[model samples]
Target: MDEWVERALARFPNVPALFGWLGLDRRGHWLIQGERISHARIVETIARNYGVDDHGRWFFQNGPQRGYIALEYTPLIASVQADDTLMAHTGRAIESVSALYLDEDSTAVLDTPDGAALVQGADLAWVLDRLRADDSDKEIDDQALSNALAVPSGTQTDLTLVVGNDRLPVYRCDRADIPATLGFVQAPEPRDGENSN
Candidate 1:
């Protein structure tokens, strides 16, 4: 195992670990030791067990869910799916070194390099503190950082003030749900005789 993976594993022994290169398919899904798991499963498990806020950040089972959500933080937009080809292409263009997956409550933290940890709640400050303390030379664009921090706090929507970076938009939701809300057309419905529709 690589040094980072080794360290991450030591940090988060319970959570699964995966590794991947910047753009290449040389990436592995979350796994317990050597057992591989699908990305869909990971997402589903996190969503079902951990509830994600509008900001796309996973949190612990505080409101509705009962467990923790697994977040995937990487420099590269590897798995981010979008309808616009240009956006997808752009995401693939920017390569990232490491990513982080943790619950909002900060109880379980997992990374590609195998450095994992458990904290109390969704302590963004603490996570940022640890990231800064680490020696990794990863570089994340300002916009990405802003998006990450844009997660809603309690019932306030004006939490944009928390983000110190002006480069990132104050309110941004890039997932598929955003497109749907923006009036993106769905696929055409088939005729009654067409394929039993």
Candidate 2:
């Protein structure tokens, strides 16, 4: 959150929070009422102000009002940078990745510094290239990949992803279990007794 936004919140402490007006798409695009936000400055500002609440709901603190974002997928979309580094859709650089998983949808979900992030669909190829046999530099074959995906969700597989100088074990995760496991709400709504208007 920005310093000015904090001051605004202090000045108008009773400003009502807004919901259902903001959303984040699978590709990391910001949406408003189902429409994409095209303005670069506005998008950047929202990204800068975005944060998660205690209830695991992600929101953008817009000056004095907090607007909860409806996420289409994971909270952040991870993109492979030219230098092979990872960056979140919110423009935050992923300094480190602690965990890795291949979801039922074949998308890579990573536990990054920002939070749990789904690798951008466009970067799946890059991820595939980095996948290796468990604890080995050998690239995994298609049959081995299939075998890994056959395991039940939440089970650690015999696969690993080569990230920079680290090799992180890969787990098989179901898409449905991602939210609870990652602790993020895909569709954020007001909690009991909270104002919906």
After superposition, the stretches of candidate 1 with alpha carbons farther than 4 Å from their true spots are: 1-35, 39-43, 52-82, 85-197
Query: TM-score of the candidate numbered 2?
Result: 0.95
Clashes in each model (backbone N, CA, C under 3 Å)?
15, 0
Per-candidate Cα RMSD to the true structure, in Å, reads 18.3, 1.2
TM-score of every prediction relative to native: 0.19, 0.95
Local accuracy of candidate 2 as per-residue lDDT tens digits, 104-187? 878789987677898888888888888988677778899989998999999989888887888888899999888888889999
Compared with the true structure, the alpha-carbon lDDT of candidate 2 equals 0.89
- Which residue window of length 10 is worst by lDDT in model 1? 17-26
CA shift at 32, candidate 2, in angstroms? 0.4
Q: List the global CA lDDT of all models.
A: 0.28, 0.89
Candidate 1 lDDT at 18 equals 20
How many Å off is the CA of 18 in candidate 1?
20
